[model samples]
Target: MQRRRLLKLGIGAAVIIGVAGAGIALIKPGLVDGKLGPGAREVMRAAAQAVLSDLLPSGAARDAALQAQLARLDATIAGFPAATRKELSDALGLLGTAAGRYALVGLSIAWAQASTQDVQQALDAMRLSSSNTRQQVYHALRDLNVIAFFTEPANWQAAGYPGQREIP
Candidate 1:
């Protein structure tokens, strides 16, 4: 009876260890501050663009022009190999606070120019959100509108735009 009890105790300990190991194995690794997978990166870029476009002027000409520019950016990304995309996305994930500030500044300016009061509020909150907080990032894009508010061509050029047609 003593030997049987010892064996049962050992079996129970082994079962507990096996269950714990299985729980750990079920979790996918490689997540940095809850940011993971190619899909998350893609979603972030898309959300950023949507927030920015809302601050642009609602003119057909500006819409067409910005569409052309975005198409170019998309084409460039599409040209990258899968490995290159992964490398670049990883690098973007690892960017420091200074780079994050620059990115936020550019996006904020775009949002200010094109977005409504609601969108501006959302963008402001997002800019202040903690980098590691994916929930905040996701929430910031919750009620975003995808409109493009824009200015005149001359005004646009004055914003230091590097267009082929120089300001006369």
Candidate 2:
């Protein structure tokens, strides 16, 4: 009887915590109309610059390309399933917070204010973190940036991927 009562209490507590967590996540201000909100966008832009710095040439060209790629990323994220989108938004929200930024990226400042090297260091730390969730966030952000960058026809040459070959 004791074991059964304890099991029931544990299950009830788990359900309550899960419901509260979901409620808090839904009320977070980092998402706008089921899309990447401003805070998320800022984090992603900084992350993109840090992750793709080597491939991006300097000056107006790089700026233009980054802007276009960010747009593509935004569109792609907008189409993600609700759960996936919520996870991403939550991650972004955490990174946007100063305490979470320091914990994850080793920076106490906002991502926009952090230098590229600092952002890179943070991302590297996340990639190497013991936490699987941190690693997942790092990989997901990097993958999105890479896919958006490499899929452009202009970048195909750089990646040595010839435009779609016409099979006779």
Candidate 3:
């Protein structure tokens, strides 16, 4: 009876190990542990849309719109599984940095293109902004350029941007 009990215990341990290994293999393709789980990408998309909405000219209407958009995103993401929700939340935090910088770049670009004194003043003021602010603005501009590159095939072709070219 003792021998039989020992054999059952060994079989149970082997089954547990095999299940664990299979689970890891299936869930972690490419060993990327921080992969955005199901539904997480959708949250990121919502966040991006919110940022784009917020970039509209600042005013009471815009403020209200931004708040409404954020609320919508929050509600939509609230139903995701905890692990996926956490991943989306973390990605959103990183995206916030990029969004701030993007906003700065958009503003800076607008200022640079303006022919009016008010816009020139705003641009000049932005030029004198703190180092951190400047970095955010510049980085955002770079990210925009990159995003735009991939967004349109024509734009990519016009720029002669080869996404992946094999070398000899």
Candidate 4:
């Protein structure tokens, strides 16, 4: 009976956390009507830096790459179906807020203010966390960053994927 009760309680807590996070997103809104509302770029930029650390070039080259990657990500996301876009927007919005950042990302610092190492550790934690929600969030961010970075043909070499040859 005790085990069953604890299981119920655990499930309930998870649901509450999920709902509260969604509530924060609803109030602050990651995107404004299927668009980048505010702080979304910072969130994505910081995440990309950490997620693609070794993959990005050094110094000024890295900065330029990030800008280009972000642009590509923005354009790609814009083309997504409305429902997927809204969900992504909501997730980004949640990460932008302090509550969501602490709860989902395990970081209290603002995305722009966080060091790449710090963000990387937080992402690692999310990846290793026992919570399914945390793992899912990590995957979403990781996949998005990876996709955004690789969309540019110039980056293919870095990923060991040479540009495709024209059909004969």
lDDT of each: 0.42, 0.76, 0.41, 0.87
Worst 10 residues of 3 by lDDT: 105-114
TM match of model 3 to true structure: 0.27
Structural similarity to truth (TM-score) of each candidate: 0.32, 0.77, 0.27, 0.85
Error of 4 at 137 (Å): 0.6
lDDT of 1 at 32: 32
lDDT winner among the candidates?
A: 4
**Sequence-dependent TM-score of model 1:** 0.32
Could you give me the TM-score of model 4 versus the true structure?
A: 0.85
Can you give the lDDT of residue 157 in candidate 2? 77
lDDT of 3 by residue, 13-119 (tens): 86775465344435432112343333333223332333343243356765554344434444544555777655444433332332321333233322223333433
All candidates in order of TM-score, best leading: 4, 2, 1, 3
Evaluated at residue 105, the lDDT of candidate 3 is 29
Off by over 4 Å in 1: 1-58, 79-116, 131-158, 161-168
Cα lDDT for residue 141, candidate 2: 76
Q: Candidate 4's residue-wise lDDT over 1-168, tens digit each? A: 699999999999979988987897788777665556667888889999999999998999999988887888887788899889888988898899887899889998999999999999999999999989889999988998898788888888987997999998
**Steric clash pairs (candidate 2):** none
lDDT of 1 by residue, 1-168 (tens): 699999999899867754543343233221233333333233333444555554334678655545543443344445657765554344334221223323333333332243445444545656666753433433433332121112234435434665566678
